[model samples]
Target: MENDPQAQEEILEELVMALKAGGQSFILGILLTSILWGIATAQIWHYYRVYRDDSKSLKRFVFLLLLFNLAQFITIIYGAYYWLITCRLPGNYPKVLDVTK
Candidate 1:
């Protein structure tokens, strides 16, 4: 495909249109995950404060679980931002998807 600006613009517009439903689903999933992560964070804090005598092994397990959730949450937020903001720019998503095919 030649680097025709009009064709590129058309591709971008088409890509955005195709993404709408999937985008809505992504937003919904992000919202639900965010709420659950928040609640889990709060509960973990409470566990640390109130369960001072929890066996060391159990405390380690809780800490590990929290770490896992934190990592997942960060990735989800980053992915949402990357796809919705960065990739939505005029040139980005088309190249990423190799839309020429």
Candidate 2:
């Protein structure tokens, strides 16, 4: 079964069908997300630079902390996406098997 060409062909066919169904939407979503992420990153950098030169230490510290939090949040979101879509199977299968049978 491990070397079954028919099974491999069937899987490829199914993958093709699935891609045909939602491939465009998937690509568009990633593109939109990337654009928005870029814009957000740029804005964060701009704000950080603007605040970095502030004369008031308190304002600088608060802005730095806020920027750090924003960065961490963005990183968490990216990590989640990576974990969900990249690191695992395309579909959400049960991670554990019921071996009682």
Best by lDDT: 1
lDDT per residue for candidate 1 within 1-101, as digits (tens), equals 34998987777677777567457877998999999999999999999999999899999999999999999999998988877777677657666456424
Which pairs clash in the backbone of model 1? none
Off by over 4 Å in 2: 1-11, 53-101
Which candidate leads the pack in TM-score? 1
Please report, as a residue range, the 10-residue window in candidate 1 with the lowest summed lDDT: 92-101
lDDT of 2 at 7: 70
lDDT of 1 at 43: 99
Error of 2 at 73 (Å): 9.9
Q: Give the TM-score comparing model 1 with the true structure, all chains together.
A: 0.79
Q: TM per model?
A: 0.79, 0.43
lDDT of each: 0.82, 0.56
